[model samples]
Target: MNLKILTLDEFSRIDFINLVNKVFEDYTVPIKWDVVSFQLDVKENSISLSDSFVFLKDNIPFGFIVVSIRKEKARIDAMGVIKEERGTGAASYILEHTVNYLKWRGIRKIQLEVVKDDIRAYKFYEKHGFREKRLLYSMILKKTINQEINYRYFPVEPRTAYIQALEIYFNGRKPNWQREPISLLLSDNRYNFTKIVTNSGEGYLVWGKLEKENVPIIDIVAKNNYTDILKASINFLKSQTNCKNILISSVPEDDYLYQPLKKVSFQSILTQSEMEKEIF
Candidate 1:
């Protein structure tokens, strides 16, 4: 089958276009164009392309995987194969090769975040000897105009106080953490972080829209509740004269945000477990 792995830059115009289109159609993900562009940006400068892999048949791309190097670990980000080529052992082969490649590169561990409800993908990871690490408690709090908090931005503003609270939120909330935002901050395409200041406090919303998917995901957000600053922001989004889907993703285990979403009747979506394998 002449199995091979390809990096973003190494991919020809045709192959890149093919993989992205497949991802959208098969995975039901939106905005393949944006992903493709962002892939090039990070793949070219930050991530080492040679570190990624592509499966091929003769010179045709049958399957591909995008691996990322973060800190001392490597993660599998985007992976997909041509529909016709699936079940031809392409997926297993690519994963096996990736493990070996990372081991040879002197790495000991690899991890990736998979979406909840993707049973097949999760099973594949299990078969490959990966173990679930953590689950996030994701929640969505809908915005209601009935409750709005007034706010100002600094000094006397509760919004300023909210940001101040966040400064300490991480310290007390994540005592053992070295940094926050984890791989989500490097670029706009990676995450949509916006600063919202209310009269009583301020916070940030890590949410954005995907090009292919009409839904705008509200990932992880931190806001102050002093005078209902959180509600105001939610109201703002709910009031948005824009077309968007207010969804949360990758909920981790024991998330404080879970309670609020449940109270507001926001449905609880399944959770994804971050899985890892020791390659070294």
Candidate 2:
């Protein structure tokens, strides 16, 4: 069995997309990527093709690890091996190579998230020196918020919202890779920001539509009065889109928005473990 790894930059864009879709076809949540979305992900996540790797067995690509870099920190945005290549040690080999490469590039830390119930994947990361740091919840509000909204929501620039969030809301919190400040800045134009000012305090909502029926709340940061701000945001979103559900993905358990999301009837549909490894 001959196995070799190559950086993603070495592969054609079409080939990389096809290989990723094939490798993740049977993943926990099957992923299908086209050129546009793939390119958008690359841009928004700061995915480093030079550092990302693909593993080929006998010249056929069967495994991949997509890495996103931000300064000295990095995240494994996605990694998978095709079903046919499972148990062939291809995944491990790819990860080992990628980690060594990242360390050599002066990365201080690496992070990734795995489904909480995916014992096999979790064990694989654990075996490779990744430790669970926190639990991230994918919360959803299915039913429309029937309560009347009294507060007015004003549209604000992404930079304005981000600056306020950084100062007050995300100051001491640990947000996941996608919700990091840099990620928000990278994808700023893709989302709309709304600010709600109340007697108690002010809050901002960062939201956008990924699909017709699904509205993703990318980030909701507030100085005080989370419930009112969240309710107003939901009501505004409901008025704007034909979305069937409002979702907030990968919310850390310790996040200020977590409890408020539950208070506003957002149920946890999925849970993931945020894992990390410190590179020396």
Candidate 3:
């Protein structure tokens, strides 16, 4: 079979979406891919179609890998091969080519996150020079508004500088490439920030709705007494938005906010392994 590779821009948006969905058809996690989510991801993470690869066999897309390049770092946003194309070396071929492409572009590091339970993918990345770095938890809080829960927080429209300041302490709380301050600031979507003050001092929460899931994704940075702050923030969300759930994704090992989040009824729904490779 003849193998060829092309970038995302080479295909129409609809075709690209279809190919990705097909490739991920039987994925471990059910991903509902669509145009809006795709556009948002690209916009928020500075993903250029030129750096994202689509592999074809005899002119039919059979595999693909998406890379988001920053100044000196690149992130593997997603990678997959069509079921029939698996075991035919298409994945290895695409990965080898993509790594070389990034290195030639002067990228100093590459990173990605894989589901913790996906042993096949973990082994694949390990075999391919990626080293496991940290454990991350995906936490979810299902909406169960208590009649007694109080909402006394005010919303604050965040400036980049303010967000950065809040992140100084919890900056690495989330995954580096996808959920960090850099990515959040670049997001075209608006964020909702809430500030609450208690006897212990002041605390704040940063959150917004997931465009596709329509659930809130939250990040908290606050004083030592953060439990009350978290509760108030959730109450505010229930009061203002129709969000029925909240997602706190990819919280890293030793994330200070994890325990506080748990105290506020956030439960761990999934786990992930953060992997990275240093490129010369």
Candidate 4:
């Protein structure tokens, strides 16, 4: 079978909304398109959190996958072959070629997660040399705006006090990725610097939109009442007239806010188990 691989930019040009919507149209006798995982269908700018490749056959898209590759390692973010095309070798061929492509790029170890319950995904990744890395837990809040969450969002620059608040809650020197973005937001008046307040002090969502969707990329930082701060921030986003979704990245598994998120209407769509392999 002849296969074509497109970069994230190329995939965005195609009408993928319908393709993905069809995949999740049926759950158990209901059309639940919104139930699709946030990572699977995202805008071009949204997917820039990392590099991704999409696969096609005969000038048509049967299925596609996304991966994040660094110099030393790579991760399979999400992958699927359309039901009709399954067992037709599309998945195997893509997986084999993609790994080689990465290997040639100097990425030694590749990783991904199979929903602990999805036997087929488990076998698929295993057959392709992905090991059981870690059991990842995912949570979401569907109905978070029901209650008036008691937290304040300040439209202010991420000052020292604000960064200090984050240090206390998240308990670390802020990662460079986050700080740089916050710094950028601070100097730019156009970017909305939304901060949340709690008894534990304050947290920040250094975000704003550069595109059609209101989903400003979240560079979340909190100190003290981590859970409360995040809940407040999320609720605020839900109330926004501008953005439809909030995309939080690189949140840790043991985050204090994880449990609270479960209590809300959030769903566990999928998890990316952390895995590793050495090339040399």
**Collision count for each candidate, in order:** 27, 0, 0, 7
Give lDDT: candidate 3, residue 187: 62
- 1-280: candidate 2 lDDT, tens digit per residue: 7877788899778998998888777777667889888877888799999988887778888888899999999999989888887897878888998899899999999999999999999999999999999999998999666545577778888788778767763468677788766676777578888887655667888998748688988888787778878888787788888677999899999887889899989999999999999999
Reference-based lDDT, residue 194, model 4: 76
Candidate 2 least-lDDT 10 residues:
143-152
RMSD of each candidate? 5.3, 1.7, 2.9, 7.2
Backbone-clash count (model 4): 7
Best by TM-score: 2
Give lDDT tens digits, candidate 3, residues 1-280.
Answer: 7878888888778888898887777887655579988888888778879999888889888888889988998889889888887887878888889999999999999998999899988998899999998888888888646434444666665554256444664644444565555665666455666676555556667777655434665566664666776777666666667677778788876666778887778889899998999989
Candidate order by lDDT, decreasing, is: 2, 3, 1, 4
Candidate 4: list runs displaced more than 4 Å: 1-12, 15-61, 140-151, 156-193, 206-220, 231-252, 259-280
What ranges in model 2 sit over 4 Å off?
A: 1-3, 210-212
Local distance difference test values of all predictions, in order: 0.58, 0.85, 0.76, 0.55
* Candidate scoring better on TM-score of 1 and 4: 1
> Where does candidate 1 stray beyond 4 Å?
1-3, 28-31, 34-37, 40-48, 136-145, 153-185, 188-194, 197-201, 209-227, 239-245
Clashes of 1: 27
**lDDT score, residue 231, model 4?**
66
Which residue pairs clash within candidate 2? none
Runs of candidate 3 exceeding 4 Å displacement: 143-151, 160-175, 210-214, 242-244
